[model samples]
Target: MSDLVSIPADAPTQGMEPNGWIVVGVPTNFFATASAHARSGPLLGAAAEVRFTPVGFRWDYGDGTSRTSASGGASWAALNLPEFSETSTSHVFEQPGTVSIGLVASYAAEYRFAGGEWRAVQGLVLVPTTPIIAIADRADTVLVAESCSINPSGPGC
Candidate 1:
């Protein structure tokens, strides 16, 4: 019965800034969730109905830096975290270039069957979720005479 569980597919959804490039040494936010991408019932070949929730994320920042985020960090602007202004899932890039970021999404699974109560699985399972995200980190060489917040169209702001 355990063998039937096999490996379930859970594609994570990614969310981040559209055009803003991450600045060197500046913390940038990345968002993702590791829930079932598609399903209405028990997974195929599984003995029971299993539901997976993101417990953590393993991040490869493409610069030899790796970190684990437990909460998948909210946006700093959203949560109002101070200083580096980061969510739990934020990363700091030290160089300027196009870096490929990889995520090994970890999930805690629970299973139940027809007329049975849900029970947590033994341990966490990790899977490489979706295409590797490429983040463009640029040098903060642009000189802004005015705050980018005040005038987004201003020169280099």
Candidate 2:
């Protein structure tokens, strides 16, 4: 996915100056790609191109865990994949649950350039629920009784 990035203000501006205001801009256009897979199964890929400066970025795979990466050249890794980078991580859900994956990118930092210092841009990703099921069977008397209490409105019931 490609998004247009914009810089943020360090603090709220109260009044307009005589000549309005002066704003600083930073270099945009960054590209990042992420791929996830079961250690032995299929792989899923996602990519994003930064259109502006971002201070921080995080990824939540909706498996009860999350990962984060910096927008700059900094790198991060996961335990399952030792040789991996920050933009990607491998995860496995312990049980069946609705997984809503997403990303949070924000302008939480300031940088100093040749001219001066300026705040960065930010973005986020919102993923819907993804069901993951693990099969198991257990016998419970309450459940059995509830199942046996049929409404008798249909043949199966």
Candidate 3:
């Protein structure tokens, strides 16, 4: 089996927001289940640190709240020789709504032990899921067919 990791965006569920919050990182993806009961349960838990030079990252809470952070040419090899870890800054949402999260990490290209030159690695984006309101006054649901189009092209002709 492959190892899985979970990252939680530390946000408030109730009461007033606090300054400087820390997010819990888990080894598995538990945001979907945990966030559902975040109001009553622990929002931040144990989380694994992600290793790699992160150039930048962005988060979009479907509720119309978003945030972004970036880093410049930081050398990790000097500290530990080609390895580094970074924890994201904490953010809180005043209102409850769906949230879409994205992340991007970059690594400086390095020549292999054999031979090569320095290069740059492309960034990455991860969209976990749209956060759903566990408890809401009113809920709306919509359904649609998997493979259906409003305007047909050939068969009828």
Which has the greatest TM-score? 1
Candidate 3 achieves a global lDDT of 0.27
Q: On residues 13-92, what C-alpha lDDT tens digit does candidate 3 reach at each position?
A: 22101111212221101111112111111212422232223234344433464545553122223223211123233343
Candidate 3 residues lying further than 4 Å off, grouped into runs, are 1-52, 71-88, 97-113, 121-157
Prediction 2 TM-score vs. true: 0.27
lDDT of 1 by residue, 7-119 (tens): 47475666553324566776777767655532235444444566677778787877888888776655545665433454667778877777777778887777776647877
Give each model's whole-structure lDDT.
0.64, 0.29, 0.27
Error of 3 at 81 (Å): 31
| Model 2 superposed RMSD (Cα) | 22.5
> Could you tell which candidate, 1 or 3, scores higher by lDDT?
1
Task: TM-score each candidate.
Answer: 0.68, 0.27, 0.28
On lDDT, the leading prediction is 1
Q: What is the lDDT of candidate 1?
A: 0.64
**Number of clashing pairs per prediction, in order:** 0, 1, 8
